[model samples]
Target: MPSVLWVSLFMWSYQKLASVYPRERPLLLLRVSGEVVEVDEKLSDLPGLVNTSPYEKGWLIKVKLSNSGELNSLMDDDKYSKFCEGNH
Candidate 1:
């Protein structure tokens, strides 16, 4: 149990730190019942986020953005970081 707690703590901290980097990109959008799903690279490794946050509880997919095109329309790391920070 203590190990689990420690691992959770580490993951949370790493997520926090990772939030500072502007790399997460929304690669796919799964629409169901007029709701839009945004998928990013994080989900590629951890697909559970999709089932858990399809819209707000199950995200559908993800993509890695390298250029400043439609990606600019998406949220930046600082913005996403702040958005998540507020949730916590």
Candidate 2:
């Protein structure tokens, strides 16, 4: 089974929250700032969900945005898909 890891950033400081064996290099998973209200414990048990059901059950964290205005700078689903295509 593939390894799973979870991290949290608070006030620009990085911390490792959880991990399984055979860690991989750090990757930018998401960028957001706010209180992390909840985490999906299910991910630790089902890491494959990150690839299999990303839009539904694979979400990493639930954040209550500190600045709702920050969302305006983020891409919607359509724009993000295009961005990924361009980068790839």
- The numbered model that scores best in lDDT is 2
Worst 10 residues of 2 by lDDT: 1-10
Candidate 1 per-residue lDDT over residues 1-88, each given as its tens digit: 1211111111222232133123454332311112222324455566565445545433332323333243334453466567678888
TM-score of each prediction: 0.24, 0.63
| Regions of candidate 2 where Cα sits further than 4 Å from its true position | 1-30
lDDT of all the models against the reference? 0.35, 0.51
Pairs that clash in candidate 2: none
**lDDT value, residue 65 of candidate 1:** 31
lDDT of 2 by residue, 1-83 (tens): 11222332321122243443124322434444567667767766776666676667766666677666655555655766676
